[model samples]
Target: MTQFIVSLAVFLALHSIPAIPAIRQRFIRVLGRRPYLVLYSLASLAALAWVFHAAFQLDYVELWPPSAWQAWFPLTLSPVAFFLLISGLFSANPVSVTFRRGDMKPGAVVSITRHPVLWGFLLWAAGHIVANGDLRSLMLFGCFALFALFGMVMAERRNWSNPLNASTSIIPFAAIAQGRARFGIDPAMILALALTVALSAWLLLGGHAALFGTDPLAMTST
Candidate 1:
C-alpha cells in the first residue's frame, strides 16, 4: 500500500492546490499560458495513472471482498461517468469551451458551480468507495470524495460571480432536455459519443491490457 498512498498523496496535493489568482497569474507569467496548461495537464494525468497502478499492484488482502452491495457501483456510476465524458467532449458547454475561446476567466464555470470537475471527482470517488470496502481504499476514496465536495461548496462561496453572456452560457442539462428541439446533433459529436461509449465498454469488459497494461477486474474477485 506504500505505492498507493504515495500516488494518492501526490495526486491529491496537485489537485488540491487552491485556484489563487496571484499564484495562477505568476505561473502563467513564468511559463506562458499554453506551456503551463500542458505541463499541469500532463502532471495530473500521470498522478492519476500512478494511483491506479499502485492500487492494483497491492498484494491480495481481503480488506473487503466484492459483495452484492457492489451491484450499485455500475448503476450509480454510469450516469456520472457519462456526464463527465460527454461534458469533456462537447464544445458547447461553457466550462469546456473556455480555453478555446481565449478566456482564462475562472468565474465562467463558477457561475454555475465553482467546479464542475470537482463535482465529477466527488461522484467518481464516492462510487469507488461504495464498491470497495477495504480500509485503505475507503480512506483514500473517502478523503478525496470529501475534499471534492468541500471544494465545490467553498469555491462557490469564495469566488466572485460573473455576468452571463446569454449567447455563450450553457443551459443546464435538464433545461436542454426540456428544450431539446433547439439542439442539433452534429456528425462529429455523434462520432465522438459513439467512440467514447465504445471505449468505456471496452474498459469495463476486462480489456484493460489494451489501455492500462492489465485487467482491473482480475485484481479483485471481491
Candidate 2:
C-alpha cells in the first residue's frame, strides 16, 4: 500500500506540471514538438509501469466482493471501448481526424468536449474499479482514472490557444450541409472497424490468458 501510494503520488506530480502556455511554448521551441511528444509518452509509460509494479507488490486487499450488479461492467464498457478503440483505429470521424490532421477544427466531437481519449480512459477506469472492489485494484485503476481526468484538463488548457471561431469556421460548414456535420465514413475507418472486430475475437479466443495472464470473461462478478 505504501509503495502503491508513493508511486501514484509521483505519477500525479509528473503529470500535474503546470499548463502555462509560455512554459509549454518554450519547451516546444527547445525540445521540438516530436521530441517533446516522445519524451512525454516515455515519461507516462514509465510512470504507469512503476504504478503497476508497486500495486502488484502490495497484497490484494479486497474491499468487498463484487456484487451481482457488477455484471454491468462489461455491458457499460463495451460501447465506450468500442467507440474509443475504433475511433483510434479508424479515421472516419472528423473528431478522430482532427488530431491526425493538425487542424483542431473542434467539430461535432470537440464542440461538445475536447478530450475524447481521456473520456474513454475515464470510462474504462471506472468500469474496472466498479467491477473489482479491491484495494490494489482500486489504487491501480483509480489512479489512472484520476490521471486521465486531470491530464485532459491540463492538456486542453494548453491547446485552448487559437481556437477557430464558430461563425467563420464551424457554423458555415454545418449550415451548408447536414452531412458535413455528421461523423463521416472513410475507408480507413472501415478498415479500423474490421480490424477491431477481428482483434476482439482473437483476444477472446486464444490471446487473453497469453497477454494478461487471465481470461477476462472468466473473472465474472459474484
Candidate 3:
C-alpha cells in the first residue's frame, strides 16, 4: 500500500512539470523538443508500470462482482479509445497536449476533440476500473481517470485564447455539432483506424493476457 501510494505520487509530480508552460519550455530548450518528448514518454511509462506493479502487490478487495457486460463494455470501447489515442498522438494540437509538434495536421481527430489524447486515457482508465472492480483497482484507475480529466481542464485554461479553440472543444463531438469544426476521413483518421484494428486484434487474441494476468476476452467475468 505504501509503495502504491508513493508510486502514484511520483507519477502525479512528474506529470505536473509539463502542465506549466515555463517549466516545460525550459526542458524543451535544454533537451530539444523531440528528446524531451522521448524522455518524458519513457519516464511516464516507467512510472505507470511501477504504479501497476505496486497496486498488484497490495491485497485485492472486491468492490463488486464482475459481469460479462463489464468485460464486453471495454472491448467494445477499445476501437474508439485507440482511435483517439493514435490520432491525437499524430496531431499538432495547439489547444492541447500532443506528441508530434511538426508536419502532422490538426485534422479529423482535433475536429472531434482538442483533447483526444486525454479522452483516450480517460476511457482506458474507466474501462480498467470497470473490468477490475476491486478496491485497489478503483483507487488506481480512478485516480488515472481523474488525472486525465484534470489535464483537460488545465489545457483549457492554459490555452483559453488559442485560435484553434475557436473551432475545437474538450468534449468530443461538441465542436462538430456546433459547426465549429469539420469531420472527415483524413490521413490521420485512416492511420488511426488501421492501427486501432491491429491493436484490438492483438489484445483480444492473446496480447492482453500475455502482458497482464487476466484475459479480457474470457467468457466468464465473475
The number of the candidate with the highest TM-score is 3
**Model 3 Cα lDDT, one tens digit per residue, 42-157:** 99999989998999899989999888888876787667889998888777676666665533467678889988888988898898788778999899989988989999999888
Q: Which stretches of candidate 1 lie over 4 Å from their true place?
A: 1-3, 56-65, 75-79, 85-114, 160-195, 209-222
Off by over 4 Å in 3: 17-19, 102-105, 219-222
Ranking by TM-score: 3, 1, 2
Query: Which segments of model 2 are wrong by more than 4 Å?
Result: 16-23, 67-104, 150-208
**Local distance difference test, each candidate:** 0.55, 0.57, 0.83
* Candidate 1: tens digits of C-alpha lDDT, residues 187-218: 43455457657766787686655765644455
Better of 1 and 2 by lDDT: 2
Error at 165, model 3, angstroms: 2.1
In terms of lDDT, model 2 sits at 0.57
TM-score result, candidate 1: 0.63
Candidate 2's error at 199, in angstroms? Answer: 6.3
TM-score of 2: 0.63
